[model samples]
Target: MDHYSFDQLPHAVSELHQKLDSIQDLLLESRQPVPQTIELMTISQAAEFLNLSVQTLYGKVCHREIPVSKKGKRLYFYKSELEEWIKSGKKKTMSELREQLPSLVVGRKGRRH
Candidate 1:
């Protein structure tokens, strides 16, 4: 260990304190609760979240049309997957379709640009 003179003691202590403060900050940050990525919902909760009737939801589940997880008699849905399922049925606007047309036309049997 390097011996510190009396004059250097306060400076060394301050530097040590700063490093401790940095470590404490990191510890506090790590202790913070992380946001949830997968939110599981029951069938009734799924129906409420999706604004659909329970009967209709059951019909969709029976037909294997919607994203679902089945455990014995219980059905589970993930909020993230349900949101993505809703987005997957989105109809493109005319402008959106036009924007995608060029990419779709390239290297296909059609009139060249």
Candidate 2:
């Protein structure tokens, strides 16, 4: 039969306790509040922000063209995503207008010989 050393037992037990304490502290710290810089908006609030009718917003959501989340019976949106959608729509409109500009300018200067 092999004999165990008594001197090593206390050190091992103390190390185990320290590890447990560290794990407990980590778990406690994870429960702390995280600071959110962006605010979440409800569907109605988002629609109002975009100056869109609620029905139009709902249609976009149904078409999966807009970013939205459904929690229970209510819908939610991130303010940033809504702003991005608005900006992208504006960009598309600007591009379309630019494409049509040549047709709108009827007067052009001819080269003089």
Of the candidates shown, which would achieve the greatest TM-score relative to the real structure? 1
Each model's TM-score? 0.66, 0.47
lDDT of each: 0.95, 0.85
Clashing pairs in model 1, backbone N/Cα/C closer than 3 A: none
lDDT of 1 by residue, 11-59 (tens): 9999999999999999999999998868999999999999999999999
What's model 2's TM-score? 0.47
Q: Which numbered prediction scores highest in lDDT against the true structure?
A: 1
Give the Cα-based TM-score of candidate 1 against the true structure. 0.66
Global local distance difference test of model 2: 0.85
lDDT (10s digit) by residue, model 2, range 27-51: 9999989887887998889989989
Per-candidate clashes come to 0, 0
Clashing pairs in 2: none
